[model samples]
Target: MPDECQPLHNINVGVLGHVDSGKTSLVAALSTKLSTAALDKHPQSKERGITLDLGFSSFTVPMPARLIAALPCRELQFTLVDCPGHASLIRTIIGGAQIIDMMLLVIDVTKGIQAQTAECLVVGEIATQHMVVVINKVDLLPAELRHKLVVKACKRLAQTFAATTFAGCPMVAVSAKPGGGDGPAPPAEGVPELIGELVKMVPAQPRLVRGPFLFSADHCFLVKGQGTVLTGTVLSGSAEVGGMVELPELRVVKKVKSMQVFRQPVSACRQGDRAGICVTQLDASTLERTLLCTPGSVPTFTSAIAAVEKVRFFSGTLPSKGRVHVSLGHCTLMAEVTYFGTPDGSGHEPAAALRLVLDRIGQLALNENVGEFDYSTDYAYQHELHGLEGRPSASGRQCQHYGPQWALLKFSQPVTAPKDALVIGSRFDTDVSKAACRLAFYGRLVALLRAEDPSELAHLRIFKLKMRAGSIDRVAPDGFSAVCKGMFKKDTDISLFAGMKVTTASGAVGTIEGSFGKSGKFKVAFPKGIVPAAPGHNSITLTFKRYIYDQNKRNMVQ
Candidate 1:
């Protein structure tokens, strides 16, 4: 347990960049400890001289003497997470990104922005809003080249940031390696400046002491007598030495035997604290990047409905039917992407609307011939399922569906992530020849699909309403003129206009013919030259029949 008398404020900072960009070296310099040891500790990493997994270390910097005299605290503690930079290890990078409150984006002055560098920046923008760009290894360049490189790097970074959430972020130049020759080497210029900028940009960790305890475990191991240990950053609430924690996905509850922050024993730790927890009666082998939460506080589900946004850098259109890797919090799952709507006739590009159905957690496929994989009868699954009466079989395959602007994700294992959590989608390509610059998309898990019917489309309807385009303007006996609310493009196909079904609040129906006038109004033809009475407000609903998909039937139907 932590000593109550020597309390330290904890801040998590992630070191991220391209492989060989000196991310580990920067972390070691900042920590002044064997931070690189943590990286190379893994046997494979040591052999390859590259980080293959997430590595963690921490260091404390003394507060300025003046501030220390006036304030109660003497130092600030920073927990550093060094993320892997190889494109194959992108999932590991995302896992590290989720736990950190801020990021140190390392850019090698010699290499500028590489493929993985941009990907790391994109991950940073998705994972955190606070960051400091560190242009490292400036000591290798001449004074003139250093200045020119810094300016050029800043311009390129600016363009990348313009398309991301971290636009207008500040950048600083530094050299993480020790200066050659001479005593002390003047402390490696820019270290102090970078720290000062980080202090200014990163906000103090937010307190979630009152919320339910939520921890996303990134690493798990076992000790001889201490039992299973889980190490991760506390995302919300707090946990004490004797408190019980639940792994909702695994459906196991265990008592905390001990807890530590940065290797110092602690009685209790709060949100934003990176902790290593020793728990009683659990096997470490069963745990892999699982979510630990206060029992019943988290909403565990096999599916999630979300609103997705495309990545501007991806050249190819999103596939309507294909596999993807979905990263939410620290857990990554294999998923299938099902697009919802037909193209707007502008092009063959896949529709923005989508649904992601993930394979159940812990379930492995016995054969690929079936539509869905077979469920594993593991202890966790059996135990959790025993309580439910008449629950559907885990083996049954069901058709998944979504709507415009919203997506539905069905997982093989229940996820304990909270609503509004960010979900990232990446290509599931295993081809090593593909460039690392391939794009990734991200979205928010807005809600869970709780409908009893697996094929129900109620949520789809709500999503379509939010994506509604325009309404009717003039009604006539044989036809109606609808003033499009800027929803239709100038190049929109005449077939799309002619295929729309327009209905009024009073149940009047009309089929569009084509464009009516120079203005953006479409001419709609009614049946038998009879137009039903228009509602008092002239409000009408435009249903794009082309976009509607029947979930139960797994086909497009009007």
Candidate 2:
């Protein structure tokens, strides 16, 4: 127990692991208190013998010396968010991971890291920097070999996470249910040791409690005649009794009647603190989950632009125009991604319609610390994913690659989220039986498209390069001109491509001045006289680009 007068600071810890890896049992062993939706309370979860939803529970410990020196709290609350490990429920895991301060990656000691463990590892790396890998169910091993095998499992896990952000993180062996599985288990082993390790690492990962009030309400229900209660973590800022909250989904405004932390009444809640907010007159059934914040703090968006980075574990390519399941806030909605890149070279000038859209993207380039899509600069359509070194040129049509990239996520339905919310794109359509990592990329929303102007970028432009090669048939009687064949069909309209630039394979630069004859052959003019090539001998190449979505049906060449 802690001093009633002393303040309590919170650290939301997520317990993530594979199915039947003892995650719920581990959480049950560690938790001193449970919230409304804690444990496997769902009827379906009990019937299936697995966790089917995001469960919330917590325990409190005396504040450590390091934290005492930094804050004014006397007790530290470790809120346990139990995330399901089933492959089909990965969307819930991804959505739940957004609110956690740190992650506890649980691994079954006997089986080691399984496929689901690997996927959870990817989410942990992308979710937060702090992680403590828990090796559970050591009690299942024979006593004679338990010590040896446990040590071996720890070493194996440490090696597997060596290159990840959690490298050198603490690894503890624990038996949540010493009697095994469920039913009236004996006292848990090594949990106290696990708690000590968590306390040590938390001081380095501080919470931000300042800013405008923003609460991520994950579970909402009516509390008899009192009112409706919204339970979740405070994403940012603080709100107190009587403070007004806007429910964007319901389009209603309500005043906070009271607040509580793990059933203890509190005057207010701040960022990083998990609390239940009670408000009057709002129907619980109206919203299953939503954001409760200062009026209009978040908006509904039909689409958005994000500065994206590829997740390394995702084995597949993130091609432009690919369909992905996008996780925005707590909503996992289907989306179509349009990826583009900014290379280092002379930027292509966009048409008038495109210039306006880029101007809008420029306004959204916020924070300044991280690069967003540059609307002032032109970008090219990326056929495949690019790394820090960029990508190779195609068809030798000349290209300059840059490291930074952006993605345009167009959702099938409208969504509500604060600006700069974390964006995770996944390919849930992938065959789960293959055990492949379906997470394609992750980024932050930089530009938001309002519902009314969904077609604001209908004419957006990204260019795909094109190249054509033809043979220098012969030098006309004049040495300054040469007839080039193979650039077009015999019946082609030769006048349409007049004056486009072409380069010879021998390093000579020239231009198509006009048509050579009715056979669709063309004459290349080299202002500086060129060495005459034997009939049908030398090679020449033509390079150009065409906008992918230009409504004018325009093409460009240089």
Candidate 3:
């Protein structure tokens, strides 16, 4: 918690770039002057020419805080995170990025916008994070090279950013080396000015109506006098001293005895602020890269996942179609890529949209773009998902016609039923059946949507269900989840109940037959016209049943 005068107006900024793009140096130059780190004077940082790990620092800006009681002063606080420029660390960088306000993208002036820059652009696209492109090392590039690089970098950024949320990011050029500022200074001038612009761009803290305080851990250490010190950018809400923090990834909850920012002790913090929480009861080893939130506010982990309609990857080689790691929030899990289905391959080049089955963790929010991966030693193999603002790309032209229509997905592991999930498809021109096979391998059911017959959904042998307009909630492309709602019309055979599980497209098996009220209202049974698939225009009704799986068993949600 910040003091009254400073009430915690924290804006988190993340630095991204190509190797040798001066990501660490910029951080070093900035933090050495304003932050508490000892200026990161490492020989390797100079010799190797890349930032090996994430760096942290802080600076103060003149801004107003939303809440006066939570601040130490009226000024806004900015936390800077310097991420590695190489591709291998992109995952780790992403873990640190969940709370960032703006990405400071650095490009080598000599090299201009290279493959890594494109990869970073893609990652930022998926995250929907804002950005500012910096053409670094201007001093090393000749005037002609510098102008050409900046233009090229801007063009590449514009194209990729256009596909996502960062279509209009600010662009500039600077050299962090001694006397690198050229005859005239960069528009923002010193790092402080750049910091100010970032503060301006970051939105105010998010409202956590009833959520656990979420802190994304980037650094953890054991303090001499304090206990475990975990530092991370706060994604949302606020936390006071003694707030119980549940570490979902580590499965531990400890009381926060104290807090700090930029190494200085503090009382409280709000969304977007970088914080160091000291938990007296926990050891440093117990804390990993995780999201620490207030116990009750944390959302439950489910096997079902909901995603937007499409998924695209940048690796031209196409993924091998197997299980891979997914890190979102603080949870890292293995998700199987069932296959590359549906070639909505419109925009961009060779990379196509793909379908993935997250083995566990269901119930993704509507239209949320998540990241994917394919690891390689060269630090060049990179991937990212894109969306057209709030929607999937317009199944654009220039896409190879992989005739398999209807975006569908099947999970290698049947998601715990009732978990919200989405079936994503790729944009490449691969055989739809082959893509379905890949999805099956990853553990998910695949289905094809006939553009001609929007009413019928083709399931790959397992189940072919028809789409009834009001029966199910369409979570994403080729995705549907059971919902409980009152029936608009009455039917003798069909009964609708609230909270009953409707299994199969038929509303049969694994369903709640009836729902009861405290007042003992009308009792209902199965409706006459209940079928595996419902009409495109009819509503999905579930009749309440007294069928309890077990008296002592917890419901599927728990």
Model 1 lDDT tens row, 143-244: 768788778878887776654456578889888775533245445667788888766654443345797898878878888877888888888888888898
What residue pairs are clashing in model 2?
none
Q: How far is candidate 2 from the true structure (C-alpha RMSD, Å)?
A: 6.3
Ranking by lDDT: 2, 1, 3
The sequence of per-residue lDDT tens digits that candidate 2 reaches over residues 300-359 is 888888877676667788777778899976888988888876543233333312221211
- State which candidate, 1 or 3, has the greater lDDT: 1
Best by lDDT: 2
Clash totals, every prediction: 10, 0, 68
Better of 1 and 2 by lDDT: 2
Estimate the overall C-alpha local distance difference test score of candidate 1: 0.63
Per-residue lDDT tens digits of candidate 3, residues 1-558? 433523546666777776667776677555532332223333565476556556677666655454344343466665677776665555555555455666788877667665556555544544435677776776665666767866776777666554444556776666666445326444332455566556556555433424446677766778787788887777656788877778754557788899877666777876666777888766677555656776745443322222332333322222423444444443344553322222233422223243332211111222333332211100111122222223223232132222221212223332221122223222223342231211111111222222123223111211111222234322223222233334333332223333344443444433444423332222223333233244453244333212121232221220
Worst 10 residues of 3 by lDDT: 373-382
Sorted on TM-score, best first, the list reads 2, 1, 3
Candidate 2 CA-lDDT value: 0.78
RMSD in angstroms between candidate 3 and the native structure over all alpha carbons: 15.9
TM-score, one value per model: 0.69, 0.87, 0.57
After TM-score superposition, the amount by which residue 184's alpha carbon in candidate 1 deviates from its true location, in angstroms, is 12
